[model samples]
Target: MPFIDLRAQYAALKPSIDARIQRVLDHGQYIMGPEVQELEQALAAYVGTQHCITVASGTEALLIALMTLDLQPGDEVITTPFTFAATAEVIVLLGGVPVFVDIEPDTLNIDPTQIEAAITPRTRAIMPVSLYGQVADMDAINAIAARHGGLPVIEDAAQSFGASYGGTAGTPRESGSAPRGKSCGLSTWGATSFFPSKPLGCYGDGGALFTNDAALAQAAREIRVHGQSQRYTHTRVGVGGRMDTLQCAIVLGKLERFDWEVAQRLAIGERYQRLIGDLPLQRLAVREDRDCVWAQFTVQVDHREAVIESLKQAGIPTAVHYPKPLHRQPAYEARSRAATPLPNAEAAARRVMSLPMSADLSEAQQDQVVAALRVALT
Candidate 1:
């Protein structure tokens, strides 16, 4: 089966997507068009944030967020070592230091307990990635940040845009009373990707930054457009980070079905966990208070290479979220301030494997993957 069934998704939303694209074409405002503002409004409303600033890419969203914070050289941003390279890359790119922290074995998110010890006078922000569609412990992280002079907490929510954190509010049940919902909205800043494969993806690269702070939102808006507070007025240093109009249209189209897609992802993830329970591998834990959107539906396995090979032979495709810890990466090795050993991150990098997952993934396809995995382990 295809790694991620974007084709199926497109087929389902063809009419709306076509109309949205056609409208953009008619307007001919390719750059920073009306759709961009419309999308920003929709996203801000969806996430319960006061403002949403669309950016060129998820990486840009993170970078712009940091720029708005006015991070300076030698300033530190504490983050997990187990996330995508872009999570920490933005920090180092701006001449800021990335302080590495380990992850929780179950959620594979940055461990909040380890964050305070890593904090220093130069620490400017705490960036925690919501890996594999599950949010990190933001309440505790926020508490820690509050204790430390209200340090900015940026949720690297590239994977967990739709996923909810029950701890902050409560959990939403299928039929029962809604558990309070909190995830991306639970931080000082939330950054999410609209890369085509994400749960809330657009047709191409697009992303957004969400925050309630009016000043930070204004700063991010400026940063997205070469730091121009007004036409040709450069207020601060910035990047060409504005999301294209066509991309914004695509995201708007995708948003129409996003709620259903999120439900499908949650259901499919639960099914995968249930069906694979009899297998020899270890499934990712979905905490009682939170759910994973299954951005990767990852599982821990021994001999991951062998398992992947077996699945590939059976016509199933799989991928890895990350293969190396940031501290071990050549680019960050010299720049990172990793005081403690990232044993969990390192072990997870070697063992974690993501299976083919999408709202469109079928039960038969899932069964085939499981059977192949069983034989591979044997």
Candidate 2:
């Protein structure tokens, strides 16, 4: 069985995807066509945001969001060290510092309790990553940000596009409540990816930004197009960050079944958890109010290498979400600002393993994975 069953998804949506692609082909305005705007509109509506600016990639989406905020040479962006490099890469790329914070042991997300201490006069923003398809602690993070002059909170929703955070860490807020709300529409800026394996992925690289602020949305729109206010008019320094029309078309097709896919992902994740309850390994924590889309159905286990090998021999695929904390990476070692040791992040790095997951993942496949894992652990 494949790790992520994209072929199954493609087979399910082949007709719509083919027709969408054909329409784009006939138009031949591949650069910035009508489909782009259509996708932007569709995504904006889906995410309950006023604006959705499609970008070339998830990294670009993060980079553009920071650029729109006008990050400066000594500015610091508070973020978790337990995420993909791109979460911190964008900060360092623009000459800003990445202030590393520890993650919660249960959710593997940034610890909101440690955030305020990390904030300083040079801090420009708070970037919280929604890891493993579940949103981080946004309520406490946002409250801290608001206390400190309303620092721009950027939700790195790359893994959590469809997930909602109804404040289980605290009281259960309404669907769109302040500070504790949906993932992409929760904070000052929401950036997500479509890396062909995400819950709502397209065929190739694509991503979008979400915001309710019109001025910031306008700034991001300009920044994506080389900071141009008009055609060939360079107003500010920027990058070529527009998502191609073809990719937009693919995303449009994928959006048709996105709601159903999210439901399947949640159901499959629950089923996996229930099936694995009797096993010795520790399952990932899905909060009471929020759901994980299970971009990767991850669990913590001991003797990880041996278990992985055994699973491999059983014809079951497994992968790690991330194996190293950003602070330990050679490129980021000099830049990380870890006030306290990241024991949880480091522990999670060594133990967490992701099983084969997708909306199309079958019960038999899930049982195979669990049985293989049981044998591997034993």
Candidate 3:
């Protein structure tokens, strides 16, 4: 049993993918072809954003967003410690500080209530990671940022590109709960990954930045092209961060059924939640106001190592989204501002385990994973 099942996704989208690839090959403008802009436009529309700038990778998307904001040597970016290193790495790379905050126990997202207290004169931005395919409290986060002299809020939506937001947490379902906004559309800069394992991914490394602010969008566009306002013009210091045409073509093909795929992911996640409800494990909390795309069907369990081994014996695959909080990591321990104890983040790190998940994952495979967990725990 494969962990992600990318091959199955490829097989399903082979026709469109092949034709798109062939078109790109025939054009031979591989650097920044028409497909790149086409993809950017398509994504902008889908995400309900004014501009979508495709970048070389998600890390580049973060770096460029910071660069576009003109983050300084001592500038601080508030973020969660319970996320991939790239979330904090980008801030440190640009000579900026990452102020680590605790996360909510239920959703594993950065706690919004803890953010304002962390803000200081040096704070330049608030970056919240939409960990494991669910958005954080953007409405409240944005409100906090607004109170702080209009600080930029960047959504590190690496795992949640297709997730929808705008439902109130701790509330009952509203009738016809239409999507209020997509992950990338709800912030000053929404950055998402196209890593193969993500909910909406291309074949290889790719990422994008979405924003409604024209100035910031233009800044990101120039920064992505080595700070060029025109050909061979270096207006500002930048990096090689443009997403290649081939990758854009592949992503375009994937979009042929992306709406359907997102829907499937949500349904599969709900079904998994129900199946594992009675199990001796803590399922991730999905708020009623929004939906999760289930980039990874993760859950919290005890004796994680033994359970993982038991699943392995049963021919089921499992993974940990992240095992260590960034503040506990060697590189970031000295760099983070631990204003308060990250009890929930620390606890989640020890228990969270991701099961094999994909749009192609079958119900039988899901049952097998649950049965293995039942045996493993016993």
Candidate 4:
């Protein structure tokens, strides 16, 4: 079984994908072509955001978001250490400090209550990661940010682009009665990846920044093209972060069936949750207000390495979304400032493992995985 099954996805969307790619080639505007704007507009409408700025990579998306915020040296960005290094790596790259906060033991997302205590005069932003396709406590985090000088909150939504948050228009959406806003539209800034494994992936490296703030959106646009306010005018220090036209074309093709794909992901994720209920593993918690797109259908198991090896032997593929927390990494340990205890993040790193997951995953395949896991634990 493929860990992510990107081949299957490509096969399913072959015709449109081919057409989109062909159109891009015919136009010969490889860099910043019409397809780029086409994708930005489409995704912006889908995400319910005022602006969508495509970038070269997910890392570049985060970096550009921070650059637009004008994060200065010694400034702090509060975030969870339990996510991909990119979450905190961007902060450190800007000559800023990454204030690490522990995650909820159940959700494995940044604990919102732990955020305020980590704030200081140096705090410039609060970044919460939507891990394994589940959103963090965004409403609570937003409230905290509002109480503290209206600090910018960036949602590291790389894994949760199709996911929805519970609240909309100052109303709670826990009951599912009200419409839920999409992940990228819920924060001051939402950055998502288009890596092949993500819920909404492009053929190559790509990402998008979403926001409602016009000034911030304009700054991101400028920063994306070598900080050019106009042609060849370097208004500020910026990186070459613009997503290529070809990659944008690929994403637009994928969007043809994205809604169906998201629905499939939701059903698959829910089925996996049900199938594994009796297994000797702890399933990641899903809040009632939101849904996971199953970017990685992860679960916590004892003897995680042994489980992985057993699955591998049974012709089943598995992976750890992150084997080590960023704070424990050699590069980030010294650079991170932790105000909350990291015991949960530490324990989660050792126990957490992701199962084979994709919108195209089948029930029989899921059952085979569960049966193998059941035997492995025995």
Candidate 5:
């Protein structure tokens, strides 16, 4: 089975996708077209934020967000060591230091309790990753930030676009509704990816930054366009990070059915968890107040290499969300400083594995995967 069913998704959304792409073609404004502003407004409202700035890729979104904060040399940004390289890469690129912290064993998100101790005078921001589609503890993280004279908090929401936190259960707002607690609306800056495999993906690379700050929003807008405050007016140094018009149009089309897709993902993920419960593995822990879109339905299993080989032999596809912690990697090991011994991060990196997951994944396919995993464990 396909690990991520983008083909099936495209088949379902063909009509709207085609129409939007055709409109972009007709307008012939591939760079910063009307659809660009249209998507920005729609996503900002959907995220319950004052501004949403689209960028060329998820990495670019993180870079632009850091740029807006004016990250300087030797500045430290506290973040978990268990996330994708891009989370720390942007910090190192700007001549800043990334202080690595451990993750919660169950949630695999940054431990908020460990954040305050990591704070030093050079600490400029706290970037917590919402790994595998569940949001980190933003309320507690924000509280910690406030205690430290309000250090900026950036949510690395690249894997969690449709997720929500701290809202009453059973009361899901409509797709366009700007309910508080949405993933991209919960922090100082929320940066997410629209890479084809994400919950709300476009056809190609795209990402967005969400924030309630008006001045920061303006700053990001300028940064994405080579720091031009106006035409040919270079106010500050920036990068060419704007998302193209066609990609924005595609995302707009996908927005039409995003709510339904998110619902399917949640249900499928829960079903996967239920089916895997009786087996010999650990399922990811989702908290009571929040929801996961299951960007990848991940589980932790022993002897992962054997399990992967067995599953591969059975014609089932699997992946590791991450195989090693960032601090363990050569490039980052020398660059990042560990706040404490990341025992949880080390253990998780050794055992975590992901199964085939997508909104289009069927019950039968899920069952097949579970059955294969059962045999693999044996």
Candidate 6:
């Protein structure tokens, strides 16, 4: 009944994980070691991007990506209000205004339709978060960005690294598919987290930035190490954002069965949808063109607090993906402005609850959860 079941994943990949860690330890190059480059290359190839820059954390990934974009003070970045704080946190930290946009009711993703209206002359970028491991409508979003003089689109893909977009249903198109675009490869800049609970995670905090622009890639590389063009030549202002070598090695180990894990997550999420179909709740909508790896298998329920208490009594663990929208939060409300009414984001915050989910989630475990939920609702 572990919420994310990381222990099970570790048990499954122990041998490879142990070996990878051992290799890192033996080399004694903890900071920006060979494994770091190896992981960057592997992830770049997997994501089908020209460059992949690893950073200390998902926040660092977003921060570095924004830095590379030259986000100036008072610049605005339009993004959904429904995502984790990091989506907007980076923008605020960089002295950029985060213009809050509403999310789609069903998908809980940033509504592409609302984006254009939010774009003012100060708007510098569009940051669309791929919430709940499903990518937002990148095609439509990209088209909008193009219409507005090609505003850089930075996909905050923290929960969607292994997910695919624009693919035919039931296809194994992780990469090497012309028609399908991987989550991190779909935009100008895609930043993803390797936080332990993500679809693709490492042992500790880690994240990466992916982009096709070589100049931007070079800029990010320099920024991650205090803006070092060479050893001591400081090119520009930057942060200590490098993802250590050991974390990179752990991610490489996790990548060994990442494909299979993605498949399992998809299947498990579908089964959850089906099992909950008759329940008094709203299932998250997955678009026909894309898949959610179910970073968290979330659903909307009435009287969420009661349901949570009941499930807790039943020994079933559940969590709220978010309890409040960013615009309503204390830290962000005064700082960020809502470009559109965030009705969906607010409603979702009150209703959405995540059940225990992982690639390692068992059928029996899933059944137990559903049964408990059913009783809770009744």
> Over all chains combined, what TM-score does candidate 1 have?
0.96
Q: Candidate 6, residues 1-378: lDDT per residue as tens digits?
A: 799999999999999999999998998999999999999999999989999999999999999999999999899999998988998899999999999989999999999999999999999999999999999988888888989999999999999989988754444444543335789998899999999999989888999999999999999999999999999999989899999999999999999999999999999999999999999999999988789999999999999999999999999999998999999889998889999888999999999999999999999999999999999999
How high is the lDDT of residue 366 in model 6?
98
Candidate 3 positional error at 217, Å: 0.9
Candidate 2 residue-wise lDDT, 43-127, digit = tens? 8887788999999999999999999999999899999999999999999999999998899998998999999988889999999
Worst 10 residues of 3 by lDDT: 169-178
**Clashes found in each candidate (C-alpha, N, C closer than 3 A):** 2, 0, 1, 0, 0, 0
Assess each prediction's global lDDT (C-alpha) against the native: 0.88, 0.90, 0.90, 0.90, 0.92, 0.93
Query: For residues 1-378, what per-residue lDDT tens digits would candidate 3 score against the true structure?
Result: 788999999999999999999999999999899999999999999999999999999999999999999998889999999999999999999889999889999999999999999999999999999989999988789889988899999999999998888743234344443236889888899999998888888888999999999999988888988889999998888888999999999999999989889888988899899988888999999887778898888999999999999899999889997899998999998877786789999999999999988998888888887788888888
Which segments of candidate 1 are over 4 A away from where they belong? 167-182
Q: What is the lDDT of residue 205 in candidate 1?
A: 91
Tell me the lDDT of model 6 at 194.
96
**Candidate 5 or 3, higher lDDT:** 5
Model 5, residue 172: C-alpha shift (Å): 13
What value does the lDDT take at residue 337 in candidate 5? 100
Give RMSD (Å) of candidate 1 vs. truth.
2.9
Show model 5 residue runs off by greater than 4 Å. Answer: 170-180
lDDT of 5 by residue, 1-378 (tens): 999999999999999999999999998999999999999999988888889999999999999999999999999999999988999999999999999989999999999989999999999999999999999988788888888998999999999998977654334434543334789898889999999999999888999999999999999999999999998998989999999999999999999999999999989999998888899998999988788999989999999999999999999999997999999999899899999889999999999999999999999998899999999998
TM-score of 3: 0.97
Can you write out model 1's per-residue Cα lDDT over 1-378, one digit (the tens) per residue?
898999999999999999999999998999999999999999888888888999999999999999999999999999998999999899999999999989988778888899999999999999999999988877688889989999999999999888887644244434432224545677889999999998888878999999889999999999899999999999999899999999999999988988899889988999989988988877887777777888888999989998888888888898988888889999889999795679999999999999889999988888888788778889
| Per-residue lDDT of 156 in model 4 | 93
Candidate 2 ranges beyond 4 A from true positions: 167-171, 174-181
- Ten contiguous residues with the weakest lDDT in model 6: 170-179
Residue 12 shift from truth in candidate 2, angstroms? 0.4
Please give the distance, in angstroms, between residue 32's alpha carbon in candidate 4 and its true position after superposition: 0.4
- Model 4 RMSD to the real structure? 2.2
TM-score for all predictions?
A: 0.96, 0.97, 0.97, 0.97, 0.97, 0.97
